[model samples]
Target: MRALIVRHEHVTEPGLVGDRLAEHGYRLTTVTVVPEPRHHAPDVPFDFPDAADWDLIVSLGAPWSVYDHAAVGSWIDGELALLRKAHHLGVPVLGVCFGAQALTTALGGSVEAAPRPEIGWTEIETDLPALVPPGPWFQWHYDRCVLPPGAVELARNAVCTQAFRVGRSLGVQFHPEITTAMVRGWLGLGGAEQCVRHGVDPHALLAHSRAMEADARANTRLLVDGFLEQVANTTA
Candidate 1:
């Protein structure tokens, strides 16, 4: 099988998620939308590949909001089109954080600023724990996804809807692909300051990530298995 990973920026990589997919016998192809140099001016022109080419599509998180067209420009529209096409083609999609917001928008929902940003590791309220575990998943977003029509909400919290499913697509508002190295990269790129503003100690957050490395990996493996067996393979 083949999996197409959409990395919104240069820093965030397909960590544990990609590992799980690989273990399940998938060849991974990654595409980066915003290069490191274009970090500030993210409204760059880009092309998204055809969704029909890949067996599965995974869209990673971004620091930007899906509704902020002024920041993302036409690329947001293009990604939405790609996701919509993927859905129509019966292609399975795993959308994380900003990607979840994008999926929600593409499926007739909307994205908006959350009451407060969810930073650091947090647990959610899940209706489908076997698939969407009520985990202490990593979260770093200022926006939330409103459920699209015909979407089954899988999980939520006091802040926002954590996970939802529509057709063969699953959208999770948390980071299951997190790694210590990824956390360090985010911190190097002003993420530390963002955490500080939100009353989260960046240093402690890093420590927590390092300490829970094994547990996080195990949880991610379960999540990937559930996505494939219960959601993606159901249609296949």
Candidate 2:
């Protein structure tokens, strides 16, 4: 099987999520929308590949908002179109954070700034514990997803909808693909200041992430297994 991984920025990588997908016998193909050079100005034109060609799609988190046209540029619309086409074609998508927001928007929902940004690890309330485990999942988003029409909300926390499903796609408001190195990279790129603004100690957060690496891997394994068995295999 083939999996198309959409990386929105230079820092974010598939990490454990990609590892699990590889374990599931998938050949992964990653496409970056905004490279390192274009981080500050991400409005560059990018041609998203056809989603129909892949067996599964995974859209990783980004530091930008889906509704921010001026910030994300015109490529957001093309990505939205790709997601819509994927949903209509029964292609399974796993959307994380910003990706989740994009999925919601593509499926007739809308994205909005959250009451407050959710940073660090948080355990959400899950309707389907087998698939969407209530976890201390890594989170770093300033926006939230309003459910798309007919989408089953899988999980949520006090702040926002954490996970949802439409067609054969699943969207999560947290980052299941995060790694310590990724967090470090984020910290290097103004994340420390962002954390300080949110009352989160960047150093402690990094240490905590390092400590929970094993647990994270275990949780990701379960998440991937359940998603493949229960969600992805389900027909549109």
Candidate 3:
């Protein structure tokens, strides 16, 4: 099997999810959507590959908001079109964070700025624990997905909706693919400043991530397995 990973930025990698996919004998083909110089968010022109070519599509997170069309409307428009096409073609999609918001928008839902941003590790309430596990999951988003019509909400919390499923697609607001290295990279790219503004201690967040590294890996593996067996294979 093959997985097409849609990385929104250079710093946002597949991390543990990619590792699990590789272990399951899936070849990864990564496409970086925005490859602009430096870590500054920019509106760059790019094209997604043919969605029919890959067995699965994994859309990674981004620093930008999905609702900010005026800023990233050009590429986000193409991304939404591609995601809709992929969904129509019955391709299984795993959308994380901004990708989840993109998926929701692509599937007749809406994305908006959250009342309160979730920055650190937080626990969620899950209706489908086997599919969407309860956390202590990593979160770093200012927006929230309102969920598409016909979508089954799998998880949520006081702040926002956490995870949902529509047809062959699954969207999770939290980052199960997070890793210490990825967090470090994000921190270097002004994430620390954002954390400070949000009243979050960057060092404490990093420490928590380091402590949960092993558990996070195991949980991510379980999530991948569940997605493959339940969401992907069932639809196939």
Candidate 4:
């Protein structure tokens, strides 16, 4: 199987998710939207690949919100079109954070600023243990997605929707793809400053991530397996 991974920025790579995809024999083709050296620049041009060639599409997290179309320029619209096309074709998609927001928008929902930004590790309530675990998922977002049309709400907490599923596509608000190295990169790249601005202690965030690395990786692996097995195509 082939999976197209849409990497929005330098920091948020596929991480453990890519590892699991490889384990499942899914070859990954990553399309880095804003490569290094120009990653922080706003309104950079984004070139997306044709989604039909891939068996699955995985959209990773990003610092930008889906509603920031003006700042993101035409790329946001292009991505939304891709999401819609993939869905219509019954091609499975898994979206995280900003990707989830994009999925929501593509499915006729909206994204907006949350009541409060979520940073660091947080728990989400879920009955779908086959897909999502109950505790300690990485989160770093100021936006929340409204449940899209025909979507099933799979998980939630006081702060956000957490996750939802529309047919074979899943949109998760939290980060299950974060590895220790990925977390460290995020913290080192002005993420600490953003946390401080949000009244979050960067030190504590790092400590929490360090403590949860083992459990997080295990949970992420399970989620990845579930996504590929239950959400993607199967030959009967």
Give the top-scoring candidate (lDDT). Answer: 1
Candidate 3 contains a number of clashing pairs equal to 0
Q: List the residue pairs that clash in candidate 2.
A: none
After superposing candidate 2 on the true structure, give the runs of residues whose Cα lies further than 4 Å from its correct spot: 234-236
Cα lDDT tens digits, model 3, 40-145, are 6568888888888989999999999888876675889888988999999999999999999999999999998899999989989999888888978999999999
* lDDT minimum window of 10 residues, candidate 2: 227-236
Give the TM-score (vs. native) of candidate 2: 0.98
Which 10-residue span in candidate 4 carries the lowest summed lDDT?
227-236
What is the lDDT of every predicted structure here?
0.92, 0.91, 0.89, 0.86
What would the TM-score be for candidate 1 when compared with the true structure? 0.98
Which of candidates 1 and 4 reaches a greater TM-score? 1
TM-score of each: 0.98, 0.98, 0.96, 0.95
Write the residue-wise lDDT of candidate 1 on 143-227 in tens digits: 9988899999999999999999999889999999999999999999999999888899999999999998998998899899999
Tens digits of per-residue lDDT for model 2, 1-236: 88999999998899999999998788999999998998999999999999889899999999888999999989999999999999999999999998989999999999988999988989999998889888889999999998989999989989999999898899999988989999999999999999999999999999999998998888888788888888888322
Off by over 4 Å in 3: 36-38, 234-236
Higher-TM-score candidate of 3 and 4: 3
- How many clashes does each candidate structure show, in the order listed? 0, 0, 0, 0
lDDT of 1 at 45: 95
